[model samples]
Target: MKAKLGPAKGKVSDLAQQHGDKIQHGLDRAAKAVDEKTKGKYSDRIQSGTGKAKDAMERLAHQEGTGPGPGAGPDAGGGTPNGPRPPVS
Candidate 1:
């Protein structure tokens, strides 16, 4: 399964790199609409999830210095090419 996902990951990463900002804007818009519809009942959870999603997207896109570097390894809590995911901070 992991091997099969490699190509998909690369494709997704490429797409994310090209459309990260648009994707983030869409996420924000969706979260805001959901919050308004729910009367802020789930605002905090929605915001938190959105933040995490954006972070993951950035990582996947290799943006904002998320690419391999100091302090970026299997222990970085970001998924590797074919390694276990560390717990999210």
Candidate 2:
């Protein structure tokens, strides 16, 4: 899901969009780990924490400009397109 943000300078929306999914994935894994460690004793707490983590990550990503993008990926001119290109002569 896309997180809304107010107009601000130095925002990194592209990065957020690209990494948000990865961050959420990691959080999910962490939550699962916690649940496993607890032997499913605190399923509710684990789930709640997971949700909070996901929400926080999304908010932070959006605030930092790493949430979803308009197109499939980040927009051009956002940063180094793809990867480092050949050095200009």
lDDT of each: 0.72, 0.56
Estimate TM-scores for all models.
0.68, 0.52
In candidate 1, the residue pairs with backbone N, CA or C atoms under 3 Å apart (3 or more residues apart, or in different chains) clash, namely: none
The TM-score of predicted model 1 comes to 0.68
Give me the runs in candidate 2 sitting further than 4 Å from their true place: 1-14, 64-89
lDDT string, candidate 1, 1-89, tens digits: 87777677778878988998899888888888888898889877888788778778877887333234676667563542544333212
For model 1 the local lDDT of residue 64 reads 32
Worst 10 residues of 1 by lDDT: 80-89
lDDT of 2 at 59: 51
